[model samples]
Target: MPLITLQNVDYSIGGPLLLDNVELSIEPGERIALIGRNGAGKSTLLKLLSGDLRPDDGEVRVEGGVRVSRLEQEVPHGAEGDVFDVVAAGMGELGTWLAEYHHLSHAEHVDTDKLAAVQARIEAANGWSADQRVVETLTRLDLDGEQDFTGLSGGMKRRVLLARALVSAPDVLLLDEPTNHLDIEAIDWLEGFLKAWPGALVFITHDRRFLRALATRIVEIDRGQVTSWPGDWANYERRREERLNAEAQENARFDKLLAQEEVWIRQGIKARRVRDEGRVRRLKAMRVERAQRREQQGNVRMAVALGESSGKKVVEAREVSFDYGGKPMLKALDVTIMRGDRIGLIGPNGSGKTTLIKVLLGELAPTSGEVRLGTNLQVAYFDQYRATLREDWNALENVAEGRDFVEINGKRKHAIGYLQDFLFTPERARAPITRLSGGERNRLLLAKLFAQPSNLLVMDEPTNDLDVETLELLEELLGEYEGTLLLVSHDRDFLDNVVTSTLVMEGDGRVGEYVGGYSDWLRQAGPGQVIAGGGRGAAGVRNAAGVAQDTSSTASGGTGNAAAAAPQATAATAGNASAAPKRKLSYKDARELELLPARIEQLEATLEALAGEMNEPAFYQRDAAAIAAHGSRLGETQQALDAAYARWAELDG
Candidate 1:
């Protein structure tokens, strides 16, 4: 039986129908990617499934005793707990028992029998090492367990909430934009974690790579209905396109018939016959249908016109180094940026990607070395934090602030006219900034930024909170942009689509330049590939294939591949080796590595059996405490298995 089902579900907020008579069923082990345009009720549907919201009409049913967990887009207000407390809350009844056990163990004059009973209960509930598991999860997400929730940044808080939802190991997990604040490594880790999940998983994300890698089914919320497609994001896109094309053709035929009917009605009949009356009614219905079709076909077009060209050398950084409080962030980085170069800056959070951008833009002076900007280098930067926007102003005022008109392609265009190009209607442009959806606000910011012409465009995290449609439009605009582009984004697909080269920041003050995109960089930096300088070669010159290119030749305008210098070996190995010896593994390490696969398989089988038992109708009728204990044990085992796999990967690498 399906774990959860939504039957004839209808929901609305203040006015328009968001979901109308939507039906859906989620089966075990199904990974569903919920996708839609902004404001398309994807979040609403997830809320309904998670029981966080009730539908105005129809029923949402869950199988008996099925557990559900959700990760909301916004962190709840007034959460006073620290990271550990918040994540542990997901443990539910098991957490209660664990707390009691701790209290009992510490109390003076405690009953010895009671203490022994509580100890057994702790073992049964898998609460013995719960704290360790929680800490591990926090570390993996780059969060500190002791950090106060109130003091955490918006992105950090979001990660905490995500960790909570994950630690719960629910039968059905509903996530809304789980990747919003995550870096590339965290996202990659989440992909692997979700793929190994044994329960029903449904999530909303704009990351194309995430959807393609994890989604077994795609559920799109469109036109007040939910449509399901089998397979990954690529399959869904192809099918959706075909479906839309067919609908467009059918609408064309309907329009022709309606036109004929209108002409016949204009001919003026003396008495209205039954057949004529029927044709008139059909024509009216066809008109309504056409209007709806037009609404469904709403598409936004984004265009960027290049401004005056800068010099051939747009930016040049020579041996740049930056440090914060004597801690090196960037060390001796040399890079040349030419006009029309599309470069993507990528690194983990707090790895100095932003600092490098500042150094290049001359916003911050490097501790050592120099930066040179070419003549007539008009730079327009889009801040990821949206710091330039005025909250008191409406969308129109925000975009049109400080000017009656803006110049685009050497033509003077009115402010409102420029706003219209970003899909903001006159009415919507008058709406307050607070009333706009995240995507709308982002679009408004883009409208304001792109209005002025610039030879160099710098954007940081531009894809955050943007719907897939808008993301695609932005990608298209960037592709056609005839200017120097410097972007920092975590979206792998977006980087692959828009950037020609990537600048990777490997922590501890090492930065590398690789030609092509993020994927190309990953391929070249894959396991067992030796890193030259801290993590990259000197001068950091790499070809499209990510092999080190001769920096001397490139600087002289010659295209030639440079052989990398080999590492020197110690005397013992260098003198007597017929072949380089492999690194010897300890006995315990070797045994564990050999047994990990079978152990993982055994754990998976055990987990599946536990889930089967918990789902049985009789399970709920049994002792509630016993059921809780089994569930907690299952969660613990899963965590253990995940750790084992992670360790194996690390050792193998």
Candidate 2:
């Protein structure tokens, strides 16, 4: 059954359409992902669906008596009750009724009127004991115990709220950025819960993995129009690519048509001196058609520019340790960031990725270590919120407020003009900062940041609210940036596509360095099968005879000429004694290292193919299995790469 329907809904603020003529009907058991760039009215639509707001020119109807609940991004943790009570409130009317029924059961309620009223209330609310529901929900959400939820951290508080919403068992669950504060373990728990959920769900989130894990359908809001895609996030991405390609083809065809029209217009005007009224009329008609064709929207382009800088180590930390309110976050960390290095600072959420960045920026002092900065380093920091602009200030004023710029080429251009290059139009330039969407504010801040010629950039969660297009632009900018970058983000695509190396802060407050992207780091440091005897037993390794093997061959005496003496081949492959013959890997061992690249390419292709299928509607019901398979395959490929890398390192290092 359709739980809710929006008929020609049009929402506006300050006379500008926020959502235009959006017609959508959501039924029970639909797990929908509401996706858009920041400021595309995704949250606004959720508000309207939740009955907290009304559309100016449309009707929103709820089917039957279906209830809706929204789990807000910023949860209120008042100084009132314990976390248990707070989460129990998600049960709404059922909870209230359960509490009243309990009171009636405990009291001496012999009065017939009181009994009838209590029974009526329970029946009206569908008569489920909220206490039992709360317990069940809390357990499923991993918030069952008092130890976990009562005296909690910020990350744990987020989990409690999510548990509360699930406990309510509403017809529709509306979640806004629910994964923002959760750690890896909690996120995994939530993912499993959502996978098994039986009700309708509409969630807006920045966690790509979470969205890919749970969303069965995707609804994208662009400009003011909502378009629905029938599969998961990856499917939406594929369809978006198809649409863009089609648009590009259509645009090319339109341009050719316009060129023909232009030639006709020129000739018609030239002949107008001797032509009749019909010729002029025909030219005008062609002109109108050309104008209509030219009405196609232009692509949004963003370019980031960085000034030249001396090639030097911009920031270095030696034995650095940090603590917050006496709890150690980062300990004995040694790191060096050089110019032009694109470094990813990754960890489970709350594992001090941000804290480490803050330490480097000198915003937070290290408890016990030295942080050295290059003499000529000019660092620009992008905060997580990127909401530093004043609410009342326009874009131009916001950009130029405290910065000083000199005239160039005898022309004085305000900071606003510079912003126009980043796609902030004249009308949007004067709009108040508060009216801008999250993505807009991020762009505005980025524009302001790049306008300054900073050599070292420290970005904290830079990809948080950015759309895929904007993120790609940022990736291109970072790729071409001449300065150093230290970015902290949970976005896997961002880390894998943008960064070259990673600095991971582990759960034990220790930091480690890895030579590649996030997935690479995860394979090397995360729990995986590591071959003994220096990558010898690892998968994908081969012997000289073209047999598939691992680095463990050297230890197991497997890499040898089948006719040659096993003891002799083992000794040759193992020791490097000064008096002994220079030990060499037999044909098999040598071939194993040589085949690493081909194996890596094969794994990459496998991952891509599996990712494509993971988004198919056929796999939505098997999301858990699909995710597990993908994760397993990813882990395997990463491990194989690691083993190959280790073998290569031994030879090259």
Candidate 3:
């Protein structure tokens, strides 16, 4: 009855068994999220489901003729051709013929004879439906069919492969970290697209937001066992906590009993009696059980090393412009980045996030305009490329920098000791980085970066490949970091948690600064678009009290508060306005404006109270109906406050 089933499966590479007596099943129409700590065999389980790997023991069964497709974490090397050909290749032999036909038909040098022959083969094989599906998938993913696949960015290549997997129309789709290289826009789109898809989804991801949005069922791999958790992400968290606590208590009881048995068995005279022979056998079995037990993995102990304070102003830009490939990447940007400001940069892939970071940090010169950095700034940068790491060195060598010890916050710690805090054993720490997993590499990079203190921290796409626990720990670290942070991440939850303000690359080299993080930007800028440079809306990034609440750097000509600015400008240009004979406010209108401030304050207090209640963990545990009602009320109250702000601005102007 299941789409795929694994029964009493045992698998391992060399040492310890990666999976032991694992039993799991995939049902049609289920969105099962496979989650675990790094090296817990999540990907290995996916391969077993896809029939890419055979279990050493037990049976894996699939319903007759059900197709399975996979999107791997790493892009396959040497993938070639335009997007269409690569995607169509997912359909096997029929796909090959259709792809050949497509390339021949679209070539600059027309190959009519070859095209016709390939077309005849495709028709004979009845592959036209697969052909249409390929085109449709490309369009859905916003991939250009004629574009060269090898030339695409890593993020784009991932998308193309995803398209290829989707074009197969498999009943089961296994995606490993599907959100890995995608930008926020692509992530949002993928969430929506996957929700609309009809096939069963078994995905492994570290994106909490994406998991919360798409997972209909939760499955986790711990030790060597696969488990299915009931309910949503919130429910899973609560349930998992309960399970772990119970396991700990049970293990304690078992150990206590085992200790008593050992003491009894040590008696010199009574232990050898014939009457105690059964007791001796039972004790021997208990020893085997204890030896076979697997302990829980230790958590990553993360801490940030902060540097001395810098000048109040961190970096300031005036009419900054950058151009590459004869096109403007940044244009006329004015921003004053002050100390301790946590800023998030969001844009599509190839939208110049890295370049903008470089230009602002004075690492790369802008094609036009000026940037000034504050004095005494100790900057620590986390490159998304991990370029700072020498591939030739292992974790210890990389973090040590030719010394056995590293100083953290004026305290010296051995390099191996520090790596241990990140969950690396001495063996792993000394092993070449090429043998480490993606998550391990990310952890190593963090270890390297945090070894030294810095007044300014710049991280680009720092959330990729990290386990959920490690990711959350890093977020907690960044939250407490006493320094300016420039974070470039597509992770919605991470951005929301770490950044107080955002600078969005809207388009055409224009950057828009708004108060708050990704969700705030969404509420202000709508779903797919961003606020244009220097533009302020009535409710753009509004906080409690219906006032614009953003501490981000303002671009040139941008106004933070139009309501406050209108009155000041009016008084400053009184002479010019006198000749114009400005229209006067009616008595009723003036009275309304006078009362608006108090009304706005009341609404703000109500909004704050509601938000505070919802922010608590227990609030989300409430019934769905109650939570939905509160959310609806909050939205209504926000709308009313925004309307009041708009009215006040109109009267003042």
Candidate 4:
């Protein structure tokens, strides 16, 4: 039986219908990927299914007693609580009791009467088991129960919401843009978790990698209608193209017939008399049908204006190091960016990709290094915060900057007309900036950023809410761009498409520059070899020779010949291995000996975890860098375990 079904659904907001005569059903254990344009009512449809919104005209049927849960695209405002309380809210009245009990228990001055009442309610409802479920979910998602919900990072907050949704144990789940702010590591973990989820899933996402990984079927909403494409993404793309072409051909034929009929009727009185009555009536119907035809929305016409050519060396840094709050953000980095080179900056969040960009741009002075910028460099920065945009102004004013026209590639164009090229309607272009959605804000920013020519383009986390079509157009534009690009995006596919090489942060000021995109970096790094984001093995991982390898070495073939200056790790260091001898045991050493057995057990456990991670089916499916990072972590863990065992034996003997 279908978990949920919609029949003859007709829904509309004040204007045109968002959904008209739509029929759909969700089966058990199906992972459905919903797709559409930015304003195509994807989220609206999810709301209808989750019973958050009722269709103006239609019947939405669900299996009896089936529970539906949805994770909203935007986190709710004015939400206050600890992680446990927020997650527990998913459990209904029992959850309220649990949350109250937890709060009272943690208060500085406990109210005994209130605490006991809440505890009694929990006992009556057998809510302890439900509480345990919340804890397990939190742990699985790496959430701290006692942490303040508002104080967590964006990714962590989203994870908490997902945990809350999961704790409900709903029969059907709907997720809207679940990967918006997640880093690559968090995204990988989410993909793995959702793959094993038992309930039916219908999610809307702009992340192509996530869609391709978990979607069993693709469902698209367009022009007030719904269509389903069975099979994988590749299959959907091919068939969708064919369908669009055929639709165009049929529309063309109908229009041609309609035009001939109009010509016959428009002739003189004698010709009108000769025309058949039935044909005249048909022509009238054709005119109405033609007027009612809903044409496809226009694609975003995106293009970047190229400034004058820059010097060959765009940016150069020698032994650059940056420290923040007594911690090294970037250390001993030597890298050069040449013109026409597109470099990707990737790393775990807070691993210092932004810090590196700042240092290179001369926004922040490196602790000790010579920084040089090439001459005649016009730099355009697309900040993730949309800092370049003015909150008080509308789209046109933002781009126009009090001028009626803006020049693009030496051509003067009216600001409103230029905005139209990005698919913004005249009215929408003039609307307040706050009225725009996240995607709209992005488009507006792009329109403003690309208005002026620049030799160097730096975009940070730019793919946040863009639809797939827009993202593709942006990628196409970037491919043809003739400038140096330093892009920092969490979108793997975006990185693969636009970046020529990658600079990955491996914690502690270590940045490894690798050839190719994300997957390419993986392939080059191999298993356990390089940590793309200082998740593990940040200092350096050991190879078979027990020598720490330097992952930050530049691979040969960068435009600037960077490999020559970078030091590459070699087997030459194997001969330098030495261990300090232990001759005596002081009181401190005696205490250490007493704790060494348990420490060995801890090392063994770490090795087991490393092995388990590598054993997963999805482990090998990731790019080579991910596999290699884990492989290196595994190798390091095993080495530690071995050393611990040896030390234990030596002391015992």
The most accurate candidate by lDDT is 3
Tens-digit per-residue lDDT, 280-320, candidate 2 = 67657766765544222233454444555745877889999
| TM-score (all chains, Cα) for each model | 0.76, 0.68, 0.83, 0.82
In TM-score terms, candidate 3 sits at: 0.83
| C-alpha-based local distance difference test score of model 1 | 0.74
lDDT of each: 0.74, 0.66, 0.81, 0.80
Worst lDDT run of 10 residues, candidate 4, spans 553-562
In model 4, the runs with Cα more than 4 Å from the true position are 526-534, 537-653
Tell me how candidate 2 scores on lDDT: 0.66
The clash count for each model shown is: 0, 9, 0, 9
Between candidates 1 and 3, the one scoring higher on lDDT is 3
Could you arrange the candidates by lDDT from highest to lowest? 3, 4, 1, 2
lDDT of 4 by residue, 179-247 (tens): 988887777667778878999999999988778777889999989999998876656776888899999
Q: For each candidate, C-alpha RMSD in Å?
A: 14.5, 11.7, 7.9, 11.6
- Identify the runs in model 1 with alpha carbons over 4 angstroms from their true place: 91-144, 150-156, 269-275, 287-294, 402-405, 526-653
* Residue 553 accuracy (lDDT) in model 4: 12
Between prediction 2 and prediction 3, which has the larger TM-score? Answer: 3
Give the alpha carbon lDDT tens digit for every residue of 1-653 in model 3: 79999999999997778998998888899999999999999999999998899999999999999999999999877678888888887888887888888877777898888888888888887879888998899898889989999998888898999998989889999999999988765676577778789999999999887786678889999988888996667567768888999999999999999999898888777555643778888999999999999888888987778889999999999999999989888999999999989999987788888889999999989999999999999999998788999999998999998998988988889899999999999999999989999899899999999987899999999899999999988987897888999999988778877788899987779888888776556545532344333133323322211211121101011112332333333344444545564468899998997998798788767876775564353664566446656756666676677677667666665
Q: Of the candidates numbered 1 and 2, which has the greater lDDT value?
A: 1
